[model samples]
Each structure stands twice: as structure tokens, then as C-alpha cells.
Target: MEFAFDEADAAFRRDLVDFLDRELADGWERSEFGLGSAVHTDFSRKFVRTLAGRGWLTPHWPERYGGGGQGAWQHFVLGEEMWKRGEPRGPQYMNVNWVGPSLIKYGTEEQKRTLLPPIARGEVFWCQGFSEPEAGTDLAALRTRAVRDGDGYLLNGQKIWTSYADGADHCFLLARTGTVADGRRGISVFLLPLDTPGVEVRPIDGFVGDHSFNEVFLKDVWVPRSRLLGEENKGWDIVRRTLAYERVGAPRYARAALVLDGLADWSRTRGLLHDPGVQEQFGEARALCEAARLLVYRVIDERAKDKEPSPRANQARAAMVQAERAVGDLALDVMGSEALAEGSRGDAQFRNSLGAGIAAGSYEVQLNLITRLILKLPKE
Candidate 1:
């Protein structure tokens, strides 16, 4: 009957909130600028180091990998608090959530020794080179090629919409190692250092915010075979699992809930709280946020128990997208023109929600996955 955090977790939450309160007292705003913006990334580099010192950056990872050796719930708790404040950890969240974990599972011992420590220490930034112009969520359609060369592979292709690429030290890149006919079976993953001889990163301006996307061109970039992750042609499995982790990685509902609270305060101040329609909107948005939170918790619970990720990740991602959209709609509907003011909660939430449906995996993709994986619906 009890659905509350246990005593220890509750206490941990209290302590973490206190720490975040002090740490972010200086008015650090991620909504005004995107997470990939120079301002945000600059602060994150300094801030994440503090978290690393506290053993919070990689608490869920193994101790040998420079983590605190905590359980998954602890990690989820960290994510929730960070997300509530627009995720001060920046791109490093990818490292802690899925990237580093992927390496842990598939990286060679040398890779782990060389890579995991820097990530756990918050000394590096990573970008994903998954989606290309030809491939979005359907990763199998990627055209980037990595041909076998003398003791390495010659990587040549371009990746679009690579977030954080401008600031990244490395990339978790996927390339085709087989013929186009091979589909998903022929792809391979590479731990690509961004400074490779033929790699070029170009910034792209987007409506979401500044520096939110980039294009990475690989012109016959030579990567030693040692940089390859897992086995060639076996990257699909890693991608699948890594994506499941990334689906619910951000604890987006936490920030959505925070925005909802701000909306409530804004409503209360404008005397709109007494309006029945406003009340209904607030109630609906709150419910959606809570639903997302619970769904994400279910996924985290499975992780805590060491269960293989399932369709629940898709369900959770769908709920989060719904929650984000609902809160954004509520902000605009309730606050009207005031919500459109730059850097306001409404403005930020609306802009952020627009991307929520598209990021990670699109909301429609999650629905398709749910139909096939959870509901067992036949695809026509």
C-alpha cells in the first residue's frame, strides 16, 4: 500500500536537494539557452566535477569503473533531482546513463581503463553519431561506411543532428560494415575520438535554442581496430539496449513537474487559480506528470532488480512525451501572451516540449513499439 521512497532514499533526496539548492543558487538557467549551448556546457564542466567529487556522477556504475557502486534507484534519484533543475550535468548525462554503461558492457579492458575513469570523473563530453541524413529513428538505414583497412577501418560519411558535437571530446558512432542489403545486421559501433584527422564538426542553428544540433563529417577518418566497440556487425544489439536506457534516461517528468509547479504559482499570482477551466488544466497536467513519473519508476525498478529492459521503456517514454506536451499546452493556454515571453517558464517549456516528442525516439515510434511489443498488435 505504500508507494513512497524508503527512509534511506528519502533522506538521500533531502540531502541532495539541499546540496543542489546551494550549488545552483547563482541563477543557472538551462531553459534560456539549450543544454548544448556554450553557457550551459561551460557551467556543466565545472559543476559535474563537483558531483564527481561527491561520488554522485557515476553512483550507479561499478566501483572498479570509478562509480559509487550504488543501486539503480539511487541513480534515478540523482537524475530526478538534476532534471528538476534543467539538468546541470549537461551532455555528461549521456555518459552516465547509457554511453558509459554501453562501454562497460562492450568495451575492451583497455577501453574501460582509458575511458570510464574520465567519464566518471566528469572530464569528458560525448556525442552520439547515430542518426544520419538518411537515418533517423530507423537506425538500420544509415549509410556511413567503415571499410576494413590495414590495421583499422577507414570511416567515411556524415552524421546529422549530432547533439553536443561542438563540445564533445568523443563520439559513440555507428557505421555500416556490411553491404546495404544487410540492414541492421551489418552495422558496427566505434568509440571515435572527435579530433581524428579527417573529422569535422559544424554547428547548425535550430529553433529549439542555440547550438542544439551539429553535423559531423568523417572523411576517410582512420580508426584503429581497438576503437571498435563490441564485434563488427553486432552493434545493433548494443544500440537496442543503449536506446532502452536512453529512452527514460533524463527523468523528464521531474522537470515537467517543476514547470507545472511554476505554472501553478503563476496562476495563483494572476488570480487565475480560481477559474474552473484553469484548475482543470492544472489538474490534467499534474496528472500527466505524475503518470510519467510512475512509469519511469517502473523502468527504474526493473533496472534495480537487474531485469532486462522491456517495452516498459517505450511506455515510459511515451508517457513523458505526453506529460511534456500537456504541460506546454497548459502553459500557453493558461498564461496566454505572457507565456511567450523569452526565458519564461511557459516559453521554455513550450520550446522544450516541441522537441520532447522527437528526441530519444519520436513519440509515434514509441507508440508503434508499444503496439507491437506491449499490446501484441499485428502489424498490417
Candidate 2:
């Protein structure tokens, strides 16, 4: 289906572009740092609050949920402009990509009323706590358990690779509510306040940045029963949807587009595009980016049609994930050691591509999801 934005959408994009241009001026654009930083500067948070005050944060969420009450198309246009300008999307992305929609779908009305406004206003930061020591790739094998108590669930387990856990106000985590025999059926989802007693957060340093990931240790932490998302023993199902929401809806592909545009600009100045080999590689990168764009649009079309879009989501996620890695590899070929520069986010596409394959789910795991869920191929 054709997914171009309407005239109204174009106007919306223009307004957002203008606002961001003003807000992210000299000494201010740094507000758009990624999740894995060791420190999130006050200026960045202030910029997010500014965006929130203007009603642009979580723009895709329902009107009743503190969102701008926009449809998906309005968002696509905004993302395109922001990413093309090499802007920061972390806060807005996390709010719209997974958290807001997840809360709307499964949270209690009280939870919705309590969380949505703060999230949209950028008053609260949320982290994802899903992968564990033994459950990174095999998420169903997670062993963190939440035992039902009188007024809350007692949590005792460790979640590794939690993004922004240190600075976050809360976490959306998956904990076991039953035994191994129950497989994925015994999982429970909860929104746990990071300040709760018995919860300890340890920061992890990653290649490009810190605050990009963390290790969270929960020891008999008490989370009120009201924090449960959806029903008990239903978290695995919730996660399946949440993961899809994260992978498909995030503006990852748009970021890739921005980096590609950078690569083109760099090549023009360096006279690299005139080289036959460089030109050929550049064409390949552009084509891959367009393919990713098409995949993203397909999923968006499915959403507009009110379909679950699970398989299409898988396709888009896998394609975009691979595209990041590929863009880096191509950039390395083009820039070589110069790709190691410390400025401008460290080689732009190359550094991002280097991490893209390993971030979220590995490209291997994403491929597995596409193969099993989308292709429905027979297993050995």
C-alpha cells in the first residue's frame, strides 16, 4: 500500500522541524544522546522536557494517553525530518516506540493515568529490563522470578544489558511467575520502580557509550500488585508484542537514511564518488537503505489497516537491523582508519553499524524470528 503522508502531515513535519531546529541549536543538540551513555546531561533532559512541553514527545500515543493524538503517518514524517537532520531520537523514540503503546494496551487505568503524562512530558525516564545472564538470546529461559505475596510480588533475580537502568524512573521487566515446565506460559510483566527497596543497579560500559546498558539486581524487591501489566502468567505474550513494537516502530531505518546521506556528503567533498569502486559501493548502500525504507513502510501500512502486522514487523526489524550493520561495513571500506575519529559520533555510519548487529537482538536472532515466524519454515 502507498504510505505517503497527506498535506496535513507535511505541515506537521514542518512545524516539528522548525521547533527542533530552534531547540537543538549550538550547544544544545547534544540533548539527543543514545541510551548507553555513562551520563545523561541535564541539558539533554531539559531539551526533552522542552519537547514534551511542546506536546511532541510520545506523539504517536493516543490522545487519551497524553500523546499528541497523531496517527502513524504524522510520526513517519516527523522521524524522517529529524533523523535526516542527524537529530537525537532516544527519548521520544522510547516513549513512542514501545512504552506508551505497551502501557495503553495492557496497563491498568490508574497506571495509564499515572504514567502517560509524565512519559509524554519527559518527566520520567523508563528502562527496559528483559535480557538476563542466561536469557539474552533465549528469552523464554529467563529465571528471574516474582513470587506472589500479600500486596505485591517479591522479585529476586538479575537482568543484564538493561538500557538506561541507572537513570530511569522505572523499568518494564519480565519475571517468572511459574516453573520451567510452564515454558513461556508462566512469565509475568511488571513496571518496577527503580527506587524500590532491595533493588540495586550497576552500570555497564559499552564500546561507543555507557548508559547504553546495565545490570540490574533485584533481591526480594516488593512491587505493588498494581504494577502488573496485563494478567499474571501472561508476560511472555506481552513481550512478544513489545519486542515487535520496539523493532518495527523505532526510527532505526530513518537513522540509517541520515547516516547514508552523511556518507554521500562526505564522498562528494573527498572526491570519492568519482571513483568507480566508491560509486558502486555507494549505489549498493543507497539501494539497501531504500529496501529498508520499503520494509518499514510495509509494516506501517499493515498498522494503518488495523492488522497485527507481526510478520511484517519481523521483516522490517530484520531488514533495518541488517541495514545498520551493512552500512557500517560499507563505510569502513570507504573510510578505513579514518572511521576511528572521535568526533561527530565517531565515524557516523561505521560506528553505529558496528554496534547495530549486536544491539537489540543480534541479526542472527532477528533472522531466526523472520525465518520461523514469517516464513513458517519446517524445523528440523
Best by TM-score: 1
For 147-259, candidate 2 gives per-residue lDDT tens digits of 98998899999999887677788899899998978979999999998999998999887665434677999998999999999999988778887887777655566777666
How many residue pairs clash in all the candidates, one count each?
0, 8
True-structure lDDT of candidate 1: 0.91
What TM-score, computed on C-alpha atoms, does each candidate reach?
0.98, 0.92
Q: List the residue pairs that clash in candidate 1.
A: none
Estimate the lDDT of model 2.
0.75
Q: Give the alpha carbon lDDT tens digit for every residue of 216-248 in model 1.
A: 999989999999999999899999999999999
Clashing pairs in 2: 35-211, 36-210, 36-211, 36-212, 37-210, 37-211, 37-212, 38-210
What TM-score number comes out for model 1? 0.98
Error of 1 at 56 (Å): 0.8
